[model samples]
Target: MVKWDTLARPKEFGELGFLDTRAMNTVLLAKRTSHIDGCEDSPCIKILEKKKVLERNFFRTSHRGGSQFWQGLQEVKCWYERGRGCTVNCGERVKFRKDVWLGDCALKTSFPYLYQIYRERQCSVADAWERDWSLEFRRNLGQEEMVEWADLSGRLE
Candidate 1:
């Protein structure tokens, strides 16, 4: 069985991608106790119930629209910030630098075969960082100067 942590990582082994932690947490919560029937005795259900109670109280005291509920639903923010170890203030600004070549990054070096596959697909460095490289591009790059081009690119991830 695949470990949840492994699945939580960016799709590819070598890519510089990261899973959003908040999203992962929500998934964990939702999947905490899977059963044939939708029983409410699961840990996830209990936590969700507690969350609902807190939200109700919060809304009653303050005019907030249960921001935590919305935030919990939109797990992107927490995932990006905690998963990547990025500063919470401006995590969105931390994207894979396009000009960087995969060959030079330590993450790529650790997973050379995967990175090579990514380069063969002629994927942009940014795409590689996001683990979005396409198999079609990989096939095309086998006949092109993709490796060289990726190597020569000035930026590093």
Candidate 2:
């Protein structure tokens, strides 16, 4: 008997090509979420915005108090996030430390020590750049932290 997984493989892979509904639904939802912000003319988006359901960035929104559809969007957001990278232009939408704009990974991952002491962790890239990338920390830096700070600054330069 042919395995279900084998049957699901692509025709190019020498198996019967079967579309996986779960993966397709996940991809479709992810695509929808990714483009929803840009679709300003969409009536559904307009309604959600009017209701204040989309006050915050859709991906960052919590599922609490939202509908099952909102919860589903939240659930499928990870798929989009995993396959996405941000390009900082005005930087209004991209999170400074959390987004993968400057490199392959996030600044928080690149500079863990600085992130731990950073006061404005939620600030966007535009805000950070406006402050000349000189972010406020919770406390004074020691010698090691000073070196890291220098390295981070050098990257910006």
Candidate 3:
């Protein structure tokens, strides 16, 4: 019998360029998840709704033990969250610093080192305004950080 791996490789690499069934399945399912935001009536979504598995936020839900199909949906959700993240409209659900609500990139991604070091800055955007940042760090930023912060601040304002 021919090796499956050999057939799965690209034609450019001297192989048959046959599509990987498992990978194709994953891509198709992930594509379907995009329709989750639409009006498409799916049995899988109904099951999740019945189970109360994140009626709003799919990322908040977990895949502990349940349907394998549900698990696959969660995997697609993981891909979505990591890529698109979330936008700050009311600033209620979106997490400040912890989520990518500010701009094109996440605060944590833009300033990975700063995010790890800053303890008081991690909170929901709503809470930050309510508390008025009593414990907000007033420490002077490094020249590079100041540049980065300025760039980020400019976009938000």
> Largest lDDT belongs to which candidate?
2
- The lDDT per prediction is 0.39, 0.80, 0.67
Per residue, candidate 3 scores C-alpha lDDT tens digits across 1-157 of: 9999999999999999998998887777777676664333777667668887747755466777667877887777666655565646667766677666666767778876455555666477777657653224446567766676666566655
Better of 1 and 2 by TM-score: 2
Per-candidate count of clashing residue pairs (backbone under 3 Å): 6, 0, 0
Indicate the residue-level lDDT of 31 in model 2.
74
Residue 135 in model 2: shift from native, Å?
A: 0.9
The TM-score obtained by model 2 is 0.73
Q: What does candidate 3 score on TM?
A: 0.66
Ranking by lDDT: 2, 3, 1
- Give the range of the ten consecutive residues with the poorest summed lDDT in model 1: 85-94
TM-scores for all predictions = 0.20, 0.73, 0.66
Estimate, for each residue in 37-88, the C-alpha lDDT of model 2 and write its tens digit: 4566787677778978898777677777788767777888766765567878
Candidate 2, overall lDDT? 0.80
Count of clashing pairs, candidate 3: 0
Candidate 3 segments whose C-alpha is farther than 4 A from its true place:
1-6, 37-44, 85-87, 120-147
Error of 3 at 128 (Å): 4.8
